[model samples]
Target: MSHTVVIKDIRNVTHDVKRIRLEKPSGYSFTPGQATEVAVDRDGWRDEKRPFTFTSLESDSVLEFIIKIYPDHDGVTEQIGQLTEGDSLIIGDPWGTIEYKEEGVFLAGGAGVTPFIAILRDLHNKGEIGNNQLIFSNKTEEDIILKNEFESILGSQFINVITREEPAGDHVFLDGEIGKDFLKSQINDFGQAFYVCGPDAFNESIMDALKELGADPEALVFEE
Candidate 1:
């Protein structure tokens, strides 16, 4: 099913990222880590559709999406950057396989953190965030999305890996590859579920590393 939603607000979270708030349709419900496909102006785009993860808490009546506007990309992201408040978009039913479990580690890169943002927010609000850890990576410190929010919810449980920034505190922001040693140092258990999201290469690398670290293949969840 599809619903027509009005753009209620827009805020810039980074140079290339925007947090878009939509007026939710009546009787809509979604899980924390679900996603929806959006279509702006029926004929305004070539593909006319794009998938975006929900960044707002599930309890909120409205829907929020954190979208990364890629100027060089050929598709909805570029078109989405041109939208303003008062515009209307077509949104599909929420769907995704990334469900929040009681104990796990969330590994995200760049815009991939959007889905987990909602999950963490919900868990924090319910005082259930203590059971999970988050490892978020980006090229630079400025590229991290919802930095303050993540820090507040995750506290010492959050690990930020900025590949291009100098090492800060006890965390080392390094380049090259992320290996089992790095994962072991940050995560408490390889027996717990591992949720990874990112670009193709990043996801693949992390999945491989988790396997090498003795993570069960059945306990890993990722976008298909």
Candidate 2:
């Protein structure tokens, strides 16, 4: 079954992303890193369902989603970008396989970082962040979402890789794609769990690289 929820608040997260808070239905709940099928509750749009990760913890009063919008797509996300406060959305039951399993490294690309948002927040809130690290890759600095929050939560453990342009302000820049060499240089133990999320190609490449670097296949968590 699906429920219609009203937009309580909505604001920009990055240049092409929106942080939308919605009214939480009584008894509604979801685990960190889980996602639900969501569609705009409007004529001609109610059936355009898409999956989006919850960026808010289960204990939060409202449901939150950090969505990346592509204006040129002329698709669901573009419609989502045009949405305003008080707009409604229809959401289905929560489902995802990217839940946190253990303290380890998280690799995210672009808007794929949404799932890790709540997972990391929950960990930080419970003082269980431990030595968890995050390696986030974006096309440019403006593409990185919640930069300050990640820095505060993970400190130096939060690694940023800018692929398209040189980021100002001393942010770490990667010359090429994340490969075996980079993984070997940054990670000391390949036995720890590695959480990865991104486009299909990115996910495939990272998982392959991790496997080649001696990371256990079972320890690689992602939305498979």
Candidate 3:
């Protein structure tokens, strides 16, 4: 089922990323890390569906999405960037993406962290955030979404790795990529649930590293 939702609010989280809140349909529900296909409810873009993770909790009165827009692509996200409070969107039924099975380390790159946002929030609300950690990598500090929120929730368990630009902390990742050495140094145990979401290359590399570190294949969860 598809719901025609009106945009209630839209605010920039970064230069290219926007946090959009939409009206939630009555009885709508979704798991913490699920996503839905969204389409601009405009004449020329109504059929162009793009999958976006839900950043808002299931109990929230409104649905939210943290989207990164690439203006040069001229795609659905670009169109979404142009939308405002009064605009409407066509969102599909809830679909599973990164289902959180248990507490463990989360490896995320860039906007891939969106799916984990709600998951972590859910855990925090339920007092299950302990034993869960987030290792997020971004090109620069400006690209880190909800930095303060994540840090507040995870405390010392949240690790931020800035690859391209100088970071505010000493924990910058100067190597430009996360590999076996880095994983070994940061992650002490590999037997827990491992959630990874990022570009194809990042996902592949991280999966390989986790596998090499003896992480259980069945415990690895990622977006399909």
Candidate 4:
């Protein structure tokens, strides 16, 4: 069933991204990395549902979503950019294709990092972020979301890649793609779990690269 929730707060993460806090329904609950259909509560818009990952931990009293809005397109996300506090949203029950099964390397592109946020935070809270690594790619440094939080949680293990800019030290990349050579140099064990998410093309390319690198296909978790 779908629940109608009022927006508790709205804030900007970047020029084109927003972080929204919504009221949690009485019986609502969801695990990290899960998502569901969401639509504006206004008339004629309630059916235009889009899937968004939960950026908030389950223990929190409110629900949160980190959304990347594109003002150039007159789509749902464009409308989302115009929303404000106290606006209502229709959210469906939680469902997910990505879940944390083990600690390993996480590869995310742009807003794809949303799902991994809660997963890592949950682990961090429990002091179980053991040997986990995150390789996040963005168009620029400004596009990286929750940068400080990721740095604090993963420390030196958090690696950021700026594709549109020059690479430096650990935040490096060649051709804007995390290919076999880069993977080999950063990750030591191919047997560990690999979590990946991004656009369809990004997902396919990364998964292909991982498979070619001898990473077990069964251990690679991603949005399907």
Candidate number with greatest lDDT: 3
Better of 2 and 3 by lDDT: 3
Between the candidate structures 1 and 3, which one is better when assessed by lDDT?
Answer: 3
TM-score-better candidate, 1 vs 4: 4
The sequence of per-residue lDDT tens digits that candidate 1 reaches over residues 130-212 is 76888988887778898888888988888888887675544558685566788988776899998999989999999999998
**CA deviation > 4 Å runs, candidate 4:** 167-170
lDDT of 2 by residue, 77-169 (tens): 999999999999999999975988899999999998999999999999999999999999888999999999999999999999888888895
TM-score of each model, in listed order? 0.94, 0.98, 0.98, 0.96
Judging by lDDT, tell me the better candidate of 1 and 2: 2
| lDDT value for model 1 | 0.85
Residue pairs with colliding backbones in model 2 are: none
Per-residue error at 201 for model 3, in Å?
0.2
Better candidate by TM-score, 3 or 4: 3
Candidate 3, number of clashes: 0
Q: Which has the higher TM-score value, candidate number 1 or candidate number 3? A: 3
Greater-lDDT candidate between 3 and 4: 3
Query: Which scores greater on lDDT, model 2 or model 4?
Result: 2
Global local distance difference test of model 2:
0.92
Give one digit per residue, the lDDT tens place, for model 3 in 1-224.
Answer: 99999999999999999999999999999999999999999999989999999999989999999999999998999999999999999999999999988889999999999999999999999999988989999998888899899989999999999889777764556557888889899999999999999999999999999999999999999998
Model 2, position 45, has a per-residue lDDT of 94
Q: What are the lDDT scores of the predictions, listed in order?
A: 0.85, 0.92, 0.93, 0.90
Worst 10 residues of 1 by lDDT: 168-177
